[model samples]
Target: MPVVFIHGVATRAGEQYQRGVAAREELIRRLLVDRMAASDPRWAGMQVVSPYWGDLAVRHYWAQATLPPVGTLEDMGVGDDGVAAADLEVADLVKEIGNDATGLEALGAETPLRNAWSKNPHRTVEALLAPIVHSDRSVLRPQDLGITEQARPAQALGEIDGRVLAAGSLAASDEAVGAAIRDALSDDAALTVITDAIVARTEQVAPVEASTDSALESLGPGWLDTLRDRVGEVLNRAKSAPARVATLAALDRYRDGLHGHLTLFMGDVFVYLLRRGEAGSPGPIVERVREAIADAPRSRADEPLIVLTHSMGGNIFYDLVTTYEPSLKVDLWVSAGGQVGQFEEMKLFKASTVVDPPAPPMPPKVAALGGRVRTWLNIYDPADILSFLVEPVFTDPDAGVRIKDLKFKSGVSALKAHGAYYSRPTFYELLGREFGSRP
Candidate 1:
C-alpha cells in the first residue's frame, strides 16, 4: 500500500533535526509492530511516510534571493547566553523597524503572506512577525487563575517588568527603542517569531523552585491571576511603543491574529473553500504532491493507501483534492496542524462531494467512488497557533468514510507546540490503530 505524507507551512529546519525523521520513522514502525498483536495479516508490511515540504518554501525564498530572518533554532535548553540572544533579537527587530531601508517588503516571496508592515517598514516590527509569533497562549485568561474582574491582572505591569528584566532578556541600547518588535515579543510573541531561538532560551525542564509562586500569592489569591495580570501589564507596556502601531488589549489576541496571515498565499485559498470556483490549473505545490505520490510505493487493492499530513501540507492537500480531484484511490486521510478547517467555512469536501451539512452532501457528486478517498482524521493542538479543526468540512456522516477531529496536546509550550506533533501520544495512537491490529 502506498502511504503518502504531507507537511504544513513554515516547517523550519530545526523541527526536522529535532524530530530526526529516520529515527522517528523507526519508532513509528516499532510502535505499529508492537501494537499489531502479531495477529493481523495486514500488519505484515506497512510503512509510515512523512513528506518534507519545508524545503519547498525554503527553496522558494532562496530562489527569490530574499533571505528571511532565520533564527538559529538550537536545542540548547534555556542555558548560557540564550536570554541574551533573545534580547539581541528584540534589539535587532527594533533597529529594522526604525530604519526605513530594512523595512519588511510589500510581499515576502518566501511564504508571500500579508504583513501590516508589509508596505510600511517603519510602522512596527510586530506587524510583520504577527503570524509567526506564539505569544497568544500566555496572555489573558483571567478565569484560569480565578482572578476576579475587579482585580484582573491587566494592571500587573510593574511585576512583569521586574521579572523580565531580572531574567536578563532585554538589555541596554536595544531596550531603549523597541516598538513593533517589543510589542510582539512582549508576551510569547517572541515565542512565535523566533521559535528555535526562543526554545533554546527557555528552560526545557520544569521549574525546581517556587520562586514565582509565593510572589504570585503576594500579588493576589490565585497564582494564575497573579501571573496573568503581570503579563497583561507587560503586554500593555509593549503596546505603548514610542509612536506608531496597534495598542493591543491582551497579548493572546495578537498571538491569535497570526494564524490566518500565515496562510495568505499572496492569494486566498479561503475564497475557493467558501465558494466553489471554476476548476483552474494546478500550481507548483500540486506538481510536488503529484510527484510525491507517484514516487511512493504504488498502492494496491489489498493494500491501504493512507496519507498523513501536517500544517500547510494539509492546505496543499486541500488544494490537491479540490482542484485536481486526482483519480487516485485514497484510503485514510490524516491531517494534523492543518489549516483546511479554516479554508472550508460552510462546504464539505469529502467523498468528492461538497457537503454543506444540515443539508445533504452537495450535488455534482463524483462519477464513481473508485478513486475517491475513504476516511479522513484530523488532529490538532489547542495551544498550536498554526493548526485548526478540519472535521466540519471534510467529515460527512453520509459519505460512509469516517472523519474525526482529535485534540492532541504535545506537552510543549508556545509556538514550538506546532512542531512537537511527531513526539505526541496521539501520533503513536493514530499510527498504531491504523497500521496495527484492531482491538
Candidate 2:
C-alpha cells in the first residue's frame, strides 16, 4: 500500500515546512501504516509520499501591500489586558524570546559532567547582565554566588525570572519594568555598557574575594567578548516596539499569520480553478499530483491506494479523480479540514454539475467518484471554521458506503484549529482506528 499526502494552501518552502512534512511522514508511518501492516501482511512496507505544490499557490505582486495594518484600539475591541483582541493572540511572540533564553540556561544546568556556568557561558553572561540592563532586582542572593559547582545552578538561574518578567510585561505606563527592558534592548550601546559592568562586577565579586582566578580563567576571555554578542542577538526581539505601538505590532503579526494565510488559501483555490488546464495539458499543480499517483508502487494488484489531503488539497484531489483523471483509483480518500463540500455547494469546481433551485443530493461529478473511490472519510473539527460536512452535500444511498463525516473536536482555539489536524498525534490515532486497523 502507498499513502499520498497532499498539503494545503499558504504553505511555503522553509525549515518549518520541511519539518512539518517530515513529522507527518513519520507519524503516518507509525500510526497508520504500522497498524495496516499489523492487520494484513499485504499492507506491509507502505510508503508515505507528500508531493509539493506550494510553488503554484498564490503570489503577491505588490509584496502583500494591499493588506491592512493593525486596527485602532476601539476597532480591535480592546481586552482587559489593554491589548487588542488580535494582539493577545500573538503576545506569545514577545514572551518566547525570554522563554528560549531561560530554556537555554536551564539546558546548560542539566548538561552532565560540567558546571552549569561553564556549559553555556553566553547564557550565564546574559543572566549576569540582566539586572544592570533592565532594572535592579536581587536575582542572585550573596549566598547563591559562591564559586563552587554546587552553588552554580542557583547563580545560573538568578536573573532568568526577572528577565522574563521584564520582557513579557505589557504595562501601559512608561514607568513599567517592561518599558525599561524595551529601552535597554533597543540601545546600541547597551551591550558595551553591559560588557563593562560585567567585567567590573566579576573582578570585584568572585575571584578577588574567593581567590578563584583559575576558575574564571577556565571559561576563557574569548567567551566573555562573544557571549555579549550572542546574548544581544537572543534578546533583540524581546524589545520590538513599546506601549501602544507594541500592541499594534503584535496585532499586525496575528493578522498576517491568520488573514495572510487565508488570502493565500483563496488565491490557491482561484488559481487551481482558473488555470487547471485540460487533461492533455494539466496545470503545474494538477500535473504534480498526477505524477505522484502514477509513481505509487502498485507491484501487487491487491495493494490499496490511499490519498490523504488537507484543506485545499482535498478539493484538488476530488477534482483530479473525478474530472481530470476519472479512471484514477483511490481505495481510501481521507480529507481533513477541507472545503470540497462547500466548493461543490458553491459550484466552483470544474466537475461541479449540481444544479441550483432545490439542488440535488449528490452532484453528478461526485457520484462519478463513487466507482473510483472505495471509502471516503471526511474529518472536520467543530472549532475549525473552514471544514465542511461532505456527507450532507454529497450522498449515494444506493452505493451503501457514503462519505463518512467524522466530527472531531481538535481542542484548539478557532483561529488555530484549521491547521491543527496534521500536527496532532491524536488525529493519526483516529485515522488508525477508523481506516487502517480494519481488516
The numbered model that scores best in lDDT is: 2
Model 2 segments more than 4 A misplaced = 71-253, 298-301, 354-356, 359-366, 397-400, 436-439
* lDDT for each residue of candidate 1 in 184-303, tens digit (9 for 90 to 100): 623345323332222222221112123222113344433333443443343333322211221112223323324433544322344334433334555455566766776766323476
Alpha-carbon local distance difference test for all models = 0.43, 0.55
- Best prediction by TM-score: 2
lDDT of 2: 0.55
| Candidate 1 ranges with C-alpha deviation above 4 Å | 12-19, 33-39, 58-281, 298-301, 346-371, 397-399, 430-439
Residue 259 in model 2: shift from native, Å? 3.3
lDDT tens digits, residue span 89-127, model 2:
223222322233442232222211112122322232333
